[model samples]
Target: MKNCDFAYYLSNFFTTYLPGHLNVSENTVYSYRDTFTRLLTYFKDERSVPPDKLKFSHFSRDSVEDFLKWLENTSHCGISTRNQRLAAIKSFFRYVQVEQPEYLMLCQSIISIRSKKSPKPTIQYLTGEEMKLLLEQPDTADRNGRRDLALLSLLYDSAARVQEICDLTVRNLRLTSPPVVRLNGKGRKIREVPLSAPCADILRKYMQERKLDRQDRMDEPLFFNSQGRNLTRSGVSFILAKYISKANAVSPHSLPSTITPHCIRYSKAMHLLESGVNLIYIRDFLGHESIETTQIYAKANPEKKRAAISKTCDDSSAPKMPDWNDNPDLMSFLKGL
Candidate 1:
């Protein structure tokens, strides 16, 4: 079968538009690619239309909506995942509209399809004491244990995403005065996060032991597996889980039952907020595109909120309101109201 217009634009969207023009990250490209893959699967299995014969005429707003429903109902995807797939489809149509204006209305329809509302995920993090206890779980005497400690320390200290930690190279580290590690965040935005002295010292020692201090090894992965390959997300998670299990055993009910690499990042942010660090600084430190994203940390912190209220309540200058129960006239008035 001949290549249809849909296939033509779709190919260019992935190959040219996303990577070449927009310069999205590989993970983003893969996510967008998966959306189309699932879409084609939907067409082939449910609509009796094979990939080779599918055309733009067969791709409609209703068909896309049906595919989203299939994702939730048949595939058992959560609301967030379903919304992400919809976003990918919508992105494709946006590119389509730009390339071929004739499809503008159709593209707009797909774009206008709102994302399904999902409940806000509670931000899970560790307190300073809990984080310290978890960090102490790794055995520093063993080579692998030392490596795990360095990895976990940097992971928490920098408040970096798991992928950012995985992507770290020897060149990203600056083990000098005011030591910092440059993190490449989502969309390939680079931000340098200052590391704690202790964390930097650990990483410096770890790098030296691995012979990564050599000039030629600058491009090598900062943290690697036994196979000498960069640590995968699953690998990082496994390492964290091992320590978490040990920490839980040592101090029962101290840590969360389950902890992901992301929880470390949240822990750092919460620690900073509790220490009176500005939200804007936290936003930049976390490499968030908006303060709104960083605000979730503040909003999720009940301790900080309670402290602020307590401080306000303790203010000496504020006049206290007269108790209505102390006055019979005021009580009668309230009763009449």
Candidate 2:
């Protein structure tokens, strides 16, 4: 099949069957798109399809298996990543099978390519001290201090994923009786989370300062740079990194490997778990499709890990051991032998 045609079919299948039947979200559709791009590049290199003659049948069971191997050995991709790619490939093959029953045999075998289950990477979050420095790091003496405080507060207040927080518009934020934020999560699924008293007051002050009339047709982003435009994701990351960097100077929380938007994600979940919030509520907060995914942070944390080891293990508590080599009974037996 032509590359363009194949691409069109893939999109159609994702839109029609994926969302309609499988109940996947828009973010999922986006992931499949990325997976296919990687798959094609691999196939092009292997088959030398420089011109326009790579057919769908080029994807045999063995070729698919080889791609799986490449995911680990060559790309060094993680388990979650490899599973997503495998899912995309399976979707494509399933579509082809429906179109051409002759490919049924091939598709059936591809279904057996199971994803290996592994514990998710441990999520890193701020220690209590770290969060203290971060919140306090925003210069309250400056004009942007309140705004910075509000932005950081809102991110943790709702336990929102970074993408969901970045995509917010002015209309999405509500500081009324419910004190809610309308978050557009993965697959464009919208959920409302409550804002704290401090967040509401800070945002109120910032909006009043900007003279942002609700009636005005402002097409710009909700959070603005100094020039007044929506804050880019990278810009937000840089902003957080700035504070994290300063905090790390005082404590180890700001180490390069330890800080990220996702770390903030972990921070919020950890806060909720410690606060005795229900896991289901946190699942809704994080916009995760399942509670199983959210439960990772609810499990034992780093401090808990250390505490567990200390509580359960102690060298002084161990049973005394005999030195059989130096014992007189063993020495006498050896001499007789």
Candidate 3:
């Protein structure tokens, strides 16, 4: 078999094009890398095409589609995840079209592969009572419990993404007058969200107790596991699940069946919308790129809809109608029809 430039193109795409030219975040690069890694593995294990012998010609439209199907049937990936992998492949091909114009037709075919549309996800969130119950599940008496309380409080208050919470450093916090926590969100965007007084106090106490407030430890992680290392996404999920289980055990129907870190963020946004906070403010607070994303909470809130309808309706000014039976002309017209 002739030597192929597939390896070379893939190498430059990740090491140069994505990082230097596109300026995508490290996390995004990792995701794209994973997509290709799985794709190569599929080709090797399924098609018997080893990485070294694989050419750009192998990634045909049908090949890509079959790979997506394999991801669903074999890997059991959801539609959203399949779409994400497809997107990564499309992105690389788009770059390929520019870098290697000779492969333009091939690239165009791969790029034309459309993402599978999934149903709009119903945003899972805790109700006010459920959130209160879950928050109270962590005992504040013990040191670990105190930390858990502060962690959960901050998670809700900032409406931080799980990754953002995991990435938080001691330096990201400012628990002084008018407290705020800096969250580094997706796409390398950073936003400072104000903390509620209670959340601020909890954080301040937790930091002081753990000696995380020291200038020397400013660069250290804000949240840690039992090993005192930065808490992973799985670790955070485990913490939330533990509390959710305890809350559900205590009061059978008080909490949702399963509560993840993201549910806490959604709960905060819902609570804020219910409080009549402006959608624009909620967008910034949640580090959302658009006000449209923040509007989901408003659309989901029944109270807001009820309030809106109540303001438009006037029971006293409504005109009364005569009974059809008593109105001979209307009865005759209806009979004629």
Candidate 4:
């Protein structure tokens, strides 16, 4: 007889039930699997026992507290990551409580472990000069350049995630006013995103260069590689990296390296928000299921944070921390770590 029931039940829930009932995308399934993996690893190390020996009977509110602490202190996870891991555990227990009543108390207790608020990550964006430099860096005069230009330009204009952008076909683009581009986004849902005029114009140039007679199979990929196959996700990243590195100073602490196709997505999101676009509109435009996800950008509003911080930081009245070098204790602690 096992001491706990999670091993047999939770495994089945994730492997079979979640897929069938949740209708989650493959990426989402993989992400949840990773969360369980991290959870199991934490359990084994923190409890001084192997994961297989861990049972629902062994789970406790104190253990849940330790699990959260482990996530922050030992695993060095951010608040969002820790919260997500807790969600995974909660969902697993929900499944367990339904199918395996022996673990009901354990499942219920973990719900008490409340998730904390995480600091919003700062958004880095490209300046106008930088964007112009990157767009011009690629030689649109050549065949490869034309293809790469279309690829990068689409990322910038659509503000699409790399995955959504890669799934694109020529048919998805409207090439007309509001220049509707059908975005096949996360969770297999589709949304039509209106393209800015600049994006539409750049895309028009690429299509003209391709000389497609409109007879080209409607299902064919919009962006193809040199060998005439669909361009890969990594290939797009590689192209962005090469150009950004060449066009910018390529510094250790600079926005150029960070400004990839995803940056273009972030750029559009921030630009729209700063322009006072409705949050609901931006949510639909980005094809995000949760408005909570879109709200991360509100906190990630770089210009506002910088301006607010700048004035306070420049204050002569603000007390400065002692230099690390001047503090022997601080220097000793740093060395110990």
Error of 4 at 170 (Å): 4.9
Top-down lDDT ranking: 1, 3, 4, 2
Q: Across residues 1-337, which tens digit of lDDT does each residue of candidate 3 receive?
A: 2467889889999999998998898899989989999999999999999999899878789999999999999999999999999999999999999988998999999899989889888888988888889889998988988999998999999999999999999999999989999999998999999999999999999999999989999999999988989999998898899898898789867677667899899999999998878999999999889898888898888889999989988989876655666657976756654
Q: lDDT per residue, candidate 2, 48-128, as tens digits?
A: 663244565566778888887788888899888888899888887888678768768978889778888978576778766
**lDDT by residue for model 1 (1-337), tens:** 2458888888899999999998999999999989899999999999999998888888778999999999999999999999999989988899999888988888998899999899999999988888989889989889999999999999999999999999999999999999999999999999999998999999989999999999999999999987889999999999999988898888866677688999999999999999999999999999999999999999999988898788888567877666676677976757655
TM-score, predicted candidate 2 vs. hidden true structure? 0.79
Q: How close is candidate 1 to the true structure, as a TM-score?
A: 0.92
Better of 2 and 3 by TM-score: 3
Q: Top model by TM-score, which number?
A: 1
**lDDT, model 4, position 267:** 78
RMSD of 1: 3.6
Candidate 3 colliding pairs: none
lDDT of 1: 0.92
Clashes of each: 0, 1, 0, 0
TM-score of each: 0.92, 0.79, 0.90, 0.72
What's the lDDT for all of these models? 0.92, 0.75, 0.91, 0.77
Against the true structure, candidate 4 has what lDDT?
A: 0.77
Question: How well is each residue in 1-337 modelled by candidate 4, as lDDT tens digits?
Answer: 4664567776788788788877777777777899878778877877776777877767788877788788899879888988888887777777777786776787788776788987655777665556667777688678888767777777876778898877788888888676888988888788888877877887888877776427565677788777777777788889998888777664333445766677778877887888789889999888888899888877778676787688788557877655666657976756654
